[model samples]
Target: MSNKVILVVLDGLNYQVARDCMGYLNGLIEQKKATLYPIQCELPSMSRPLYECILTGVPPVLSGIVNNQIVRLSNEESIFSLAKSQGKVTAAAAYHWVSELYNRAPYDAVRDRFTDDETLNIQHGRFYHWDHYPDEALFLDAESLRQQFNPDFLLIHPMNIDDAGHKHGLDSRQYRNSARAADIYLSNYISTWVDAGYQVMVTSDHGMNDDLSHGGILPEEREVPLFVIGDTFTHAETTVKQTELCGLCCQLLGLEHCKPYAPEMIAL
Candidate 1:
């Protein structure tokens, strides 16, 4: 692969909230340094299902990882698997669910929390088991991984926004503050990644609702944002789907996509 990619999944960040509260990202949009695409996530709008969807380009129904409780290793070809197969390095500083989905099952907190085995789908990992794990710390962990391994594909999944949304509803101050805080944290590393030739894509798995719960069809629970950074995109108007992200990652990392995706979403 000739290019590298960094995919940031800010769990439970709503499109509208991100548009309003993420000042740093919106500023980049105004300056034409980034592009924002408001995307409606797949049905059910839950974290686990959409996480699988984003990485594998498969819908919940087809993947059989339809719910959060259906925890098992994924069977489909993910960006990590594809990159690794091509002898590219892969890493993630994400929630333990990601470790469970890609590296091992049942998440042995003792052994699976911090892994650096090349045989695993996520070759280098720093897995956190709880939602309360600080977002700033996760970013630091991600940066450490990048500096150490220079992974070809890196997945950074932070859960503070979702944790805030779950504890206090989407309408609450905590949820909004969490998004803003994440934006601030992102400001610390995005330019460095871009300078180092990483195509950065900041997005969310799903959204949250006023009742402090999700898994329904409400707009508040489905619509999320995708921020495309670096020099690979065009200004043309485009519509993107949640499942299309996996293909986009493959395209950025110079890999052949296994699933159908709109090539118009990115420019070569």
Candidate 2:
């Protein structure tokens, strides 16, 4: 089986918002017959740290990526580096802080100096707003990248719904509209990839509260959805918490020896 994986990060996406789109997603799930896991996101439920954890299979304490602004390197190497060592092709495209922290020019400079034949593409763009409707351009760009690179691993980050929720509270019409927009865009992307025979994994960095704010360890902010769709996946529901997701991705990608956070359930 080709261990191709696509990771999609929906920035600031709450479980409730995902639930709202569940009808659409459920149909896709049935059509694709993919596995679904409800995973808890990281603590503080912020962006940078959560992405770091997903990329490295280690917590912020070990990855030294604790927030959205600053980064410090810990001993743990990222999954990107690990994939490179295994001769697996990898590609990434993201918006906002997650992309910024990982694809910093200085970091890229150093990586380029040592790595060849490894493909990493990071596109920067603004979050949601009519002004950025063309932001869907990123998806088109990513599709082009996928065709060109045919990477074993691919990551895409979409940020508008989260941006809207943060600015206008989760219940606002704007937030709802943004959520709907995200659903449309995501559905299109996943369906396209599924037709192309790629296994797609979708999740969020962390969730937001009804008030559209979070930096706490609350369940509303930490609970996120994890869904896997493709021929490679077996359709079933598994209760997977956030920390366990990194390891699960590694497993799905044929890196069975990779270490993952021990599964632990937090009371809702």
Report lDDT per candidate: 0.92, 0.63
Please name the candidate that would achieve the greatest lDDT relative to the true structure.
1
List the candidates' TM-scores in order: 0.98, 0.81
Which ranges of candidate 1 are over 4 A from the true structure?
none
In candidate 2, how many Å is residue 173 off? 2.2
- The window of 10 residues in a row where model 2 has the poorest summed lDDT is 122-131
> Which residue pairs does candidate 2 place in steric collision?
40-242, 128-160
**lDDT at 61, model 2:** 61
Cα lDDT over the full model 2 = 0.63
TM-score of 2: 0.81
Candidate 1 residue-wise lDDT at 60? 92
